[model samples]
Every structure is written in C-alpha cells, then in structure tokens.
Target: MDHILVTGGAGFIGSNFVHFLVEHTDAKVTVVDKLTYAASRESIADLPADRVSLVVGDIADQPLMERLVAEHDAVVHYAAESHNDNSLADPSPFVHTNLIGTFSLLEAVRKAGTRLHHISTDEVYGDLELDDPERFTESTPYNPSSPYSSTKAGSDLLVRAWVRSFGVQATISNCSNNYGPWQHIEKFIPRQITNVIDGGRPKLYGAGQNVRDWIHADDHSSAVWTILTTGRIGETYLIGADGERNNLDVVRQILAHFGRPEDDFDHVTDRAGHDLRYAIDSTKLRTELGWSPRFGDFEKGLADTIEWYQAHEAWWRPHKDAVEASYAAKGQ
Candidate 1:
C-alpha cells in the first residue's frame, strides 16, 4: 500500500505502528484520532512531517470515515475505548467507540472497497486458568469478561460479519499485553514504573498472581504489518512473544531494576471480573508469515521500557499525579 489510514494512531500501539511504518515502508500515513485522554499528539510529533500527518476526528463519523477510507489504500482499525478500569466506571464510551465505531468503519471500508485490518485484544478470549496448559488461539471461544473486552469481542464479530456478508477485505489480530514507550501512565506497567520513578512503592492489585503474556509494542507493530501485507483475508492471527509473566514477578522485576526491595509494594483490591491469566499461542502467525518478536527476553524488554520512561519523564509527568489520585480515590 502506498498510502495508509490509521485510526487511533495517536494512542500507544497505533502510534508505535505508525512509527514502524515510517521506518519500514515507503507509505505515507494519515492518522485520524479523537485525541482522547489516553492519546497524545507528542507521541507522533517528532516523526517526519513529510511522511506522517494527523486528522482530528472520530471513527464513528461515517461521512468523515467514508472520505478518508476512499483516499487510503488500506485502513488499520485501532481506535477503541480500551481501559478496563475506565470501562467498568462507565461502559457508554466503550460501547459507542468499540462497537459503533467499528461498525461505522466496516461500512466505510465495504463501500470504498478498501482493505482493512482490525486490531483487537486477547482479552476477548477471557482469562485462562493460572495453570492451564493450553493458550489462546484462533479457534478459542469468545468469553470476554469485562465491558472493555466484551465490546472488543463485539467489534471483532462485526469485522467477521462484514467480511463474510459483504466481502470486505479485512484481517483481524488479537494481541497480548503490550508494554513500551508512550503508553499512558494509567496502564499497569507504566503506572508501576512511573510510581517507582516518583520514589513511591508500586501498588499491586490483590495477590498480584494474575498472569499476562507480554509483548513489546515494536514487535506487535511488526507482526501487524506482516499480517496486513501477507495474511489471508478473513484469517485471525494471534500475536505473542512467549513472554508470560505473572503480576507478582513483573513488579519484583521492576523493583529489582531500581535496587528496591521486591516486597515493598502494597496490595490493593483487584479489579472486578479480572481474568486470572492471558496467554497467546502465535504459532500460526510465525509459521505462516515468518514473523517473530525481537524482544524475546522479558527482563531485557522491561529494562528498556524503564529506560524509555526515565528518559521521557516530561512526556508522561504531567499526567502522573492525576492518574495516581484517580486510583487512590478508588482505593486501587
């Protein structure tokens, strides 16, 4: 594709993918974002202006999307109300953005005959048992737990329906937890890392035994690019890097890197309906697309993420206090 339109391109993963495209492809990228609290223009500010541009808008704006989709060779749908905590507090935005927004995008793509790639979360498969031998795959049943996940599940279904019924050229990828730079401080990893930077003990939810299969954003970006270019239409790919680490271990590793005691953190109430574990088996993606994650070492990737947060304090600092206060209000 010579030109691409990316929804939610100002947010964490989408912005990373935009950066990846600039470095890896000759395509010109136009990013449409609502500029929500979780997204930052600064994330994309330093990218080459000649190659990237931003349009302030919502994906649910049907007329706007129709115009934009008609211009780009392909669309990568990444816009969604993604925070589980926020979704729990209020599901209205989640439903509107994740479901209604996706429906709007699908319609636009169907009309424009544009190729599309839908981004989704592995949480749609719900949580696995802490000791389950099997991981989530393309065939895994949908068992979403939270409003955030349920709406994402709904959005994924919309893409499949559009593809089967309307012959819309689209592919879907449900990725595991992503950790890297430019992530909002409200997220788990960045929240803890920033707490440490502020000389405060990191807060843990419940026992901190919940496991998340982590993947670096760079790797996720590369895998998505691979799928968009080479994956089969109507195929669902699971993207992961075998980087499974439980919450306790993740916090300990963060404390270790900072020369603090591992058990210095406090335990907060766990999230309602929080899944116990999430693991992704990406064998099909690797075997079929010849794609693999570069950040195989979870510890090394964690360290690099810490370094990025430390170096870019100015980017995330303004929001740190408000995020912590919000969590404190909920006793989390």
Candidate 2:
C-alpha cells in the first residue's frame, strides 16, 4: 500500500504501529483520532511531517470515514474505548466507538472496495481458567464478560459479517495485552511503574493473581503489518509474544527492578468482573506469516519500559494526579 489510513494513531498501540510503518515501509500515513484523554499527540509528533499527518476526527462519523477511506489504499481500524474500568462505569462510549465506529468504517470500506484490517483484543474470548492448558486460538468462541470486551467482540463479528455478506476486503487480528512506551499511566504496567517512580508503593488489585498474556506494542505492530500485507482476507490472526505472568508476579518484578522490597505494595479492591487469565496461541501467525517477537524476554522488555517511564516523567506527570484520584475514589 502506498498510503494507509490509521484510526487512533495517537494511542499507545496505534502510535507504535504508525512508527513501525514509517520505519519499515514506504507508505504515507494519515491518522484520524478523536484525541481522547487516552491518546496523546506527543506520541506521534516527532514523525516526519511529510510522511505522516494527523486528522482530528472520530471513526463513527460516516461522512468523514467515507471521505478518508476513499483517499487511502488501506485502513487500519484501531480506535476504541478500551478500558475495562471505564466501560464498567459507563458503557455508552464503548458502544459508540467500538461498535458503531466499526460499523461506520465497515460501511465506508464496503462501498469503496478498500483493503482493511481490524484490530481487536483477546479479551473478546473471555478469560481462560488459570489451570487451563489451552490458549485462545483463532476459532475460540466469543465469551466476552465486560462491556468493553463485548463491544469489541461485536465489532469483530461485524467485520466478519461484512466480509461474508458484502465482500469487504478485510482481515482481523486479536492481540494480547500490550506494554511499551507512550502507554497511558491508567494502564496496569505503566500505573505501577509510574507509582514507584513517584516514591509511592505500587497498588495491587485484590491478591493480584490474575494472569495476562503480554506482548510488546512494537511486536504487535509488526504482527499487524504482516497480516495486513500478506495474510488472506477474511481470516483472523492472534498476536502474542508468549509473555505470561500473574499480577502478583508482575508487581513484585517491578518492585525488584526499583530495588524495593517485593512486599512493599498495597492491596486494593478488585475490578468488577475481572477475567482470570488470557493466553493466546499465535502459532498460525508465526508459521503462516513467519513473524517473531524481538522482545521475547519479558524481564528485559519490562526493564526497558520502566526506564522509559522514568525518563519521560514530563509527559506523564501532568495527568498523574487526576488518574490516581479517580482510582482512589473507586477504591481500586
């Protein structure tokens, strides 16, 4: 593709993908973002101006989507209200962005006959048992437990239906949890890393036994590009880096990296309907597309993430107090 349109390109994962595209490919990129609180322009501001441009808009705007979609070679749909806690508090924005926004994009792509790729989350398959040996695969049944994941599941189904019923040229990828630079402090890893940076004890939810399959955002970006360029249309790919650790283990590791006692943390109320575990079996992507993660070692990747947060305090400090206050009010 010569020119690609990316929605939510200012957010953590999307920005990472945009950077990957600029460095690894020759495509000119246009970013359409609503600039929600979760997104930051600074994340992508340093990219070459001629190669990358930003358009302040929402994916749910049909006319806007059509105009942008017609001008691009392909579309990477990444905009969504993705926080589980926020979805619990209010599901309306999730519905509008994840469900209706995807619908609007699908309609535009269907009409234009443009190639499209939809980014989704593995949480749409619900949580696997902590002891379950099986991991989520492309054929896993959708059993979403929260408003955030359910809407994402609905959006994934929408893409599938459009492909089958209207012949929209599209592919889908559901990635595991992502952690890297430029992620908002509201996320789990960045929250703990920033808390420790501020000389405060990291807070854990409940006993912190929940397990998540983690992948670096950079790896996720590479995997998405592989699927976007090489994979068959109407197929779904699962992207992961085989990083699995429980919340307790992750917090302790963060403390260890800071030279603090492993037990030096507070336990808070758990989130409502939190899933137990999420593991992805990405054999298809690896074997079919020959993709591999450069950050295969979680400890090294995490240490790099910690260092990034430490060095980028100015970018995160302005919003730290408000995020902490919101969490405190919710007792989590």
CA deviation > 4 Å runs, candidate 2: none
For residues 128-245, write the lDDT of model 1, one tens digit per residue.
9998999999999999999999999999999999999999999999999999989999999999999999999999999999999999999999999999999999999999999999
lDDT of each: 0.97, 0.97
lDDT of 2 by residue, 1-332 (tens): 99999999999999999999999999999999999999999999999999999999999999999999999999999999999999999999999999999999999999899999999999999999999999999999999999999999999999999999999999999999999999999999999999999999999999999999999999999999999999999999999999999999999999999999999999999999989999999999999999999999999999999999999999999999999999999997
User: Which pairs clash in model 1?
Assistant: none
RMSD score of candidate 2 (Å): 0.6
Q: Model 2 lDDT vs. the true structure?
A: 0.97
